[model samples]
Target: MATEDDGVHTICPYCGVGCGLKLKPGEEDGDVSLQPWFDAPVNEGALCIKGGASPQVVNHEDRLTEPLIGDGDGEFRTATWDEALTLIVDELERLAETYGPGATGFFASSKVMNEENYLLQKLARRYGTNNVDNCTRMCHASTVYTLRQSLGAGAMTNSMADLEEHGEVFWVQGANPAEQHVIAHSNYFREATRDGATLIQVDPHANKTTRDADIHLQLEPGTDIPLLNVVLKTIINEELYDETFIEERTTGFDHLEATLEGFDMEEAAERCGVPLADIQEAARIYAEADNAAIFTGMGMSQHTCGVDNVQNEVNLALLTGNLGRPGTGVNPLRGQNNVQGTCDVGAMPNVLPGYLEVDDDEARESVEEVWGFDIPPEPGLTNVEVSNAIGDAIHGLYVMGENPVMSEPDALEVENRLNDLEFLVVQDIFMTETAEFADVVLPATSWAERGGTVTNTDRRVQRMRKVTDVPGNTRHDLEILCEVGTRLFGDGFDFDGPEDVFEELRDVCPIYHGMTYESIGYEGIQWPCYEEGDEGDQYLYQETFDTDDGLGVIRGVRHQDPKEVPDDEFPLVLTTARLEEHYNTGTMSTRSPTLRRKTPENFVDIHPADAEKRGIEDEDYVTLRSRRGEIVLEAHVTEDIKEGVVWTTPHFSDARANTLTNDVLDPLAKIPEYKAAAAEVEPV
Candidate 1:
């Protein structure tokens, strides 16, 4: 029988597109069905495949229902909430007392809401440490570092509405929005292209985004800096730059010019495996357009020179003076739903709430005054640093909604390190691969069972309503964090619900200070809403940039090779990206029957020539090996990928691409080189 439709509105938790969703409860409890939320903001009722199948996991068979405590061995025994909470609190206190705050690491999750991440970071700082970070460190940490250094804000400079309405050209590089951010592509980008906006795509391998591209520049992987530098050179040589804007609104022009002095554009083009003429033309179109937007992704990040790679995009936007407007800016298409908010609320190692630097005495003091506790001033280790220091410095690990065992690079080593940790605690809704190793597992409510706020890729802060009742005995994530904070620290952690916690978050987070449940309404409000009556901005940096000098920073960057280059033994370059049907680590997506049937397991895309040489036919099971480890999976012989490069994704648990991904991080951003590696294929 058809149940009465009691529609509850929320945001799609799949991608950063933040498509609005309307959920209806069935006759039974926890039976939620997805309905198109017509006139709801963002995607306008259109849902992607991933978003449509999201409700399947709300009542999945694998849901974590109760608290669990690990025995002396690897086995686990079900325990009451009291027993589990006590063990976790005791272990955390003991670790801090014995090895100090430096011995513990806290990982916030991008999958969670802004309110939850804020509280987690606050708890970490209140407990006396800044050693906290999220999955952004693996994807867009470099983009954030570069954007913060150059433009004063690490998020997208333009909103999707403005980009669709005013954008004349879309210059996309290293990102596959059509495949990854499906809703964003379908509604905004694909619509914009049909209406006359030019689509210029630059990627190592052709994918969904390439189908709509007016210009597809398929350059080699790990060579983003070189390709972008060539575009910069063409703009400078042809005098295509906006001289007035460069002179008045930007700094460091001379440094850029000096770096590009006598630069050989032809040689750089050859090095990146892209035609020089195509790169130059793409540059000319972008520079000449009235409003051109740049969208970058993990292909530009996840390298030793990830910072430099993104800095060049900044250089492109600044030199051409395409920023400070409705549609023109460098927009990093974020991978996860709340990754942007995770950084904005200062869940990382370096920043406090509101992107305030931990080392800054004034910033630290301001936050301390509100929290009633003195925070650690020095910044601590990143996620990778914590992993590398697992046995030596970090004795305990706290994970929330993140499966680092499958998410982090060098997965085999990460698993071994996780096994040796003294104490491990995980708070999530499902029995994740990482949760199996936890000493104390705290079951938390799913997104459909909670209400909170999450900031999307375009800096739009929207509200998500609880669509159903909590499954089994699971508690809310906010409640779990609150209990831990109250039991351990004894003050500041007492919160009635999500609204109460959000009120406290607004008190310290300046960007969110003006927003409340009533204010955030259905349409949602873009941030930089500093005061109650102030309407949020549609685009940032209109008159002056947020840089210290109030001018856009312009600098040139040189190309750098991947840390692990292909050798005779490993003769193919292995690069990783996400698939349309799967989210990262396949934690929630794989559990859905529709998504599972669509793409059941991992597969590698290889050039026909390479597969032929390896005696591998289409759909043949192959062993893909790198310097670190190997995994067996089916191979598809195709020319979609370049001859020397092999492409796969990081979604499957049984066979993850991260097993072969190099862990050499970008020195400044601490992001791993998950995009490129050296590997070989053998028929299994």
Candidate 2:
């Protein structure tokens, strides 16, 4: 909502910390300025570097002010909205009419509001296709899979505020909150640590979070399952397991016990490249803490064994009575602003709105009754699967605010696959790398020029107010989608605006049913608010799990090697992560002068020992290669990384980390193994 004097309240469009700020028009149109929202919820007026400089991109020199139509050969011409919309509608209709609904795929964006993504998925379904997905598949799909199976929900079990208030120990694995989530670390986690909460960090690279950790376990990449198994073995051997809680609130303990019956913890620690004694010490501290929380990240989720890696974390939490409490449970540090909400609103291939299974007859019928159409019973392709099917099953693509060209693993192949598409349409504020390949591009309004709601990392559904007028001829994402859907089907797309679309979304999404613009005032409401006046839950499963039997399911998982292991040809492990100043794929962050000045280009981090072995010096331009692709970038020889592990970020297009990353996916969640890949390096 707008403040008293021409300022509007909105959430930062960067990370999931959801810092609140106010925006006002400048001396001219398309210019914006930031004002601290002192009474805003979450960050309480705190603005990270990215949040403070977010307005820079609103008036970026590269903003797409009008629609454009390209001739499929790196050439484009300005076009009216009517001409662009008609071209898109005719192409989409022709594709489906000639091939099938399966011939098309939709990519929703985590940077967009929950309401916009909800409408996009609805349009895809109404057009008779289930091939829709978002960036969550690239980051936290495995975490969601394991959590929903074991503990029932697919999000953070406890909010940041509750974790700071009651948590005694913080077991952070595979995540760096200090860099990725600045406000969350500075305001909540750092304060919690200062107040006596023990911080245990487990990662292959020593990041900013490692500096603040009481214990840092720098293990080898792709060894999360083994490391966690060693910890579980230590907990069970010491008789520190919560016997009463396990017997009363959980099941399948025998399965977990039998799997580790003849376990060799020393061997597990050796595989993890850590000492057995240190694992035991960390396990004891975690098991003995009155309240402990586990933070999982891409390190745990972006592997071929991603599902198994996270399930072991669940086994640890359940074995030590960490579930069903205010300060405990396995939490995923979401990478994007609305990643949690994107999945919550059902912008995925296999689920309907509110995570309802598309194949479930009863649930599918309920949604069909509301939309006046029948949804396909079988699930469709995920993001990577859709990419693989570009020349075959998928002939057309519709991308909204997502850049798969830079974000996808083995991006060179994804870049090539775009050329094989019969049609490609991109709706975004700026012309991203992916948008350059589009047959038609729809110019959309910036975040400060749109009004909607976004769900934060902790499940709070907060509202974003429109603070400025849209630029030349640019329309809202919702408006562009409505025009396309109405132009094609001519029904179920007559919504006036985002607020009108949200009302229909509430009827289908049960978790967001109890919320409204008025009810979700300055302080947003958390999900699972089933009815009006409900305060919502700060932590889930206080008494019983959400599983069918009302008991948390305990399972056992063993270590599995990465899809590609370093051999003689490629004798080094390549790990990838993002920096504090950048967001995924460098769409909006690279345009910000503040963020670009801090991190102007991409670079690789190589340990001094490894650099010396290759006769390489610091700041040398290095050519890094994998079996798939190669990129040349500068190097930093430091002790921050392990001896055989080279780390890099995926923010720059010239040296995109995804170009050399493996495309092998986890079996269940289908997430690419971005954390570990067999690679080689040499002087450029």
Candidate 3:
């Protein structure tokens, strides 16, 4: 039914790697197939299992194809687009006028394109509310907040390509790229390892990524700060730190040194449950290398001390002079494809586009002048805070492409809060667990059926073209956003298409000023493209940092225990992880027949020692209970995890991991302590 010309060039919509993909029409009329783009700079013809199985979800039967309005009695009736939009406008206006703008909140999507996110945030601000946030609050809010505080920028300091080109050593912490970001692992990390770069993995579990590592320091859960502090002390005591770079390019080293003086290597080794020799060796390998990179993940950013953990990571990089150059810098592997772009476009509660604080009068006025609307000076609630504020400070909610009911910590509490909302709207491609609580559900097109730009983890901005038609009566996210915007705020939202929104975005967002769709040909350009015809910088801070003094700041960090520690009642530490076959919340991936067949249900990975202690055998049905709630899943006894720790994936709804995760928030980043929660397991 289609020819060669029908092939659409795009980027993978799964992870932050943002691998280039070629979408071709499949056997069916609207079906599509994915082909890896060899010429692409990021993936280089390599794709993970998730990327290969992406097409299976494009035509899934469960896709939401029509607007549905809930009848008070748990039934949904098909409604016209006009009917749904009118109801939404009326309810939003009623709530805003009755309870004031602060009573309503907007939750943007990290999966959607930059144009859509910009418009969604614009809609919130124009409606006289600053209550806007995204999924980043759940994943990398600490990384962004901490990096901006220490290095003056809140993004990956170096490119993925640099890992292979100039890297001599790699220090991976609290991440399993082999499962989460497979293409990046296969293409860059694997190549770096092959070329003699030493790979040191620091995690609570020995995973597939750690299998190939030169050394695996499998430490205790929630001991990131202590372990890293020991590494810093080793580098300092051995005189392996770059003194000249520290003196010239950084500040606050004196305070950092004072903090390190209090951390004893032997004590830290015992506290972290890792050998002192292993910690010293890993530190030596990193410090002695000519160039090294630090890669972190959600495992480091989802704790009560999340910001401190990232700050220490930054401290390690600054101390070793491993920044602002190829193969060297602090890099955080983002969880979502467009999460970096979503935050960049000002979906955050406290900032405008480009990380400009909303309280800053100049920045507020600049954005106000462009949109002809006064911006809110006060900051709003975060994702976790929004859930807590529902039924009290917040009443109405607008959620786009995010399923907080499944993804948020304490799943039962989130579900209860959603039900308590006076009014709720969910815009997504499928009927998600979160949508079940929505008063109205609007059908939205998937990534394969939409055209927009998404920024990758490496800050590369690439265009995603529409590969096929919308499945049914579903509308593009931009169309839904614009209709809502125009109806709510008179004429500011009248735009031709996504390009018009992007053009307007370029005018306001300094980081995206010089980029155009034409310039971003098949392979997209990285950000900080300040002018036309300028090739974006591959790595940042090569000459000067983005700080006021053009110097990296070393923030003094102290180690702290997790909010909830294991005790006699709950003797094991429970941690959440990802499965290679599934994506976050399992909305799209679980719907795919191929991925579902590969991983049909969730399982708790228990250490053999723990399993034996509990009389739990492999494949045994087990009940895992935490302080908040409990979940029942099959047991997977393995030595991959540590003795006192157990791991599980949060992909299946029947055995929802979030139900048992802790909701304790990090004081700074407001991220839930999803990494380390106290729990007890029993064989059923």
Candidate 4:
């Protein structure tokens, strides 16, 4: 970011495409432009509305400048940096003394840079507790869990570049890339369609991405497992499955086959509300492809059965021998910039940094040698469990760069639990919904105000350069976490900056052994990269896996019905998602006039037939209710949504969908029932 330099080369802050950008810094104090870099390999001179407006978000007026402490009287007043930090430390220390370390919990931000996220997780571990989780727990934890169960690792098996070379069929389910991940959809859908590749889409609603689909299975919500099982049965019955691949490359097919013996195509068709012909067509299309890919979104991973949805997708891929090849694998498009990086850094509670399970003695010893502390051997509570346990025994909560009030499931329950905590500290760029519940809110810098490396959805690491000076008393999240940690644990916690933190992170996390700012340069290298001299492949697990036997372990996943199903009282299935205009929680996108203007408010999309049946018209104010809670939103009558179901974006404050979302979680992954919550909509 030199003054004399013509343009700054950087990566797009939005989506997994990780498009390279030529940024022209603001002339005075507030200006930004997207000068496309045509030579970039990922996205060549093209960006969605998000990528074009990313820089503008950095200089938004709503950016927090100074720390704010909630005066015991319920009002937040401005405070000095020293005052805020001291107050937070004193309260947290008091909480740790009164209650055990397990009583306190921490939640990291997915949008935070990799270095900052690494520090936040480290601070939690050093505090002698594993009650630390991130946005990934709610979003893609199931995807990671299922993939790791089936494949060797929890990442995209192929690179985006592979979409151009080898893709005969693209089965995109539960993902609508046209709105959220626009650039990725453009590259894969456009290229695959041009080459006459078959495109099969499975979703409750006919989303923007479904426009290019050759076959669209508009199935009933929460029936993903039944539909997927039908496809697998079709693959086996029609002799479309790859017998050789299933025999050599995978295990657990016998159990899966036995489970499918009872579930025939007709039963699945009845359950999923799709025609038998359509299900069979989709199965044939997928099985016939020489090279195929499965691209899923939050639609699959945000449900109580989120893990099972992803596990089925993987089973299909493995059965066809579509994995470990170019453009043929399961790709769960991540929402945030560093969600992959945050997970790779092991920011989750149950795992040490680098995804090494905390309970593993060998892994704990490795991290212990580096940090010189005996790591915890027990697995900690997940996010929802942590908040639920707050009032009873949990006394303190240290949240960094996360707004769980509007984001987490069962908002009312979360608010109640958070209010019961004795001490609560929040570090964020804004006084968000979650921060409003905090005793102390520490001001932190945004992405543009920091320099570090972030891993994208495809596991591609890229450098994030600091372009502007942090405003007022605000500081980077890494510096804040380090300061608080030093105060609590003494001077042993020493690090120069993000680079030093990254060096230690790489040393502990073997997947990132070869990555560094110097070696990666502007375009960060992909993980499992080994080092400079070693080669980086577009695909993983070509020959063997990183498991006990060095082979891919396919789990025999049993299909379980959703905890909540549509009944006489709640006859409609409600699905939650993000819009093209707003990112998660509307903290960033709502601040931008351009993006905000496009989506001024949130509205629920109901099928015209359903609306008419309920005597509701477009724009009619209605209350959508579930067992958790209820929310009032205007109705959007459209055919895009299937009958007996409704759709709404979860990025607005006025219509916080999480309020009505059930907190019942998957037994394995612990993800909430976000994809399909049985709720009835009534016109006011």
Per-model lDDT: 0.91, 0.91, 0.90, 0.81
TM-score of each predicted structure versus truth: 0.99, 0.99, 0.98, 0.97
Report the C-alpha lDDT of model 4 over 550-582, residue by residue, as the tens digit.
655555455567788889989988888888777
Distance from true location, Cα of 313 in model 3, Å: 0.9
User: How many angstroms is residue 341 displaced in model 4 relative to the true structure, after the best TM-score fit?
Assistant: 0.6
Angstrom error of the Cα, residue 443, model 1: value is 0.9
Candidate 3 lDDT by residue in tens digits, 9-125: 788889999987789976664599777677776887688888888888788889899999987556899999999999999999999899998898899998999999999999999
Q: 1-684, model 1: which lDDT tens digit per residue?
A: 112254888999888888888898877768998898878779989988999999999989889898999874668889999999898899999999999988999999999998899899998888888899999999999999999999999889998889999998999988999999988898999999999999999998989999999999998888888888888888988999999999999999899999899888999999888889999989999999999999999889888899999999999999999999988999999988899888888899999877888999998888888889998889989999999999999999999889998999999999999988999999998888888888998889999999999889999888988988988889998899999999998999998888888898888889888988888988888888888877798899999998999999998888788999999999999998999989999999999999999999999999999999989999999999999999999998988899989999899988988899889999999999988899999999
Off by over 4 Å in 1: 1-5
Of the candidates numbered 1 and 3, which has the greater lDDT value?
Answer: 1
| Ranking 3 against 4 by TM-score, winner | 3
Per-model RMSD to reference:
1.8, 1.1, 1.7, 1.9
Candidate 4 residue spans exceeding 4 A from truth: 1-4, 556-558
Residue ranges of candidate 2 with Cα displaced over 4 Å: none
Q: Order the candidates by TM-score, highest first.
A: 2, 1, 3, 4
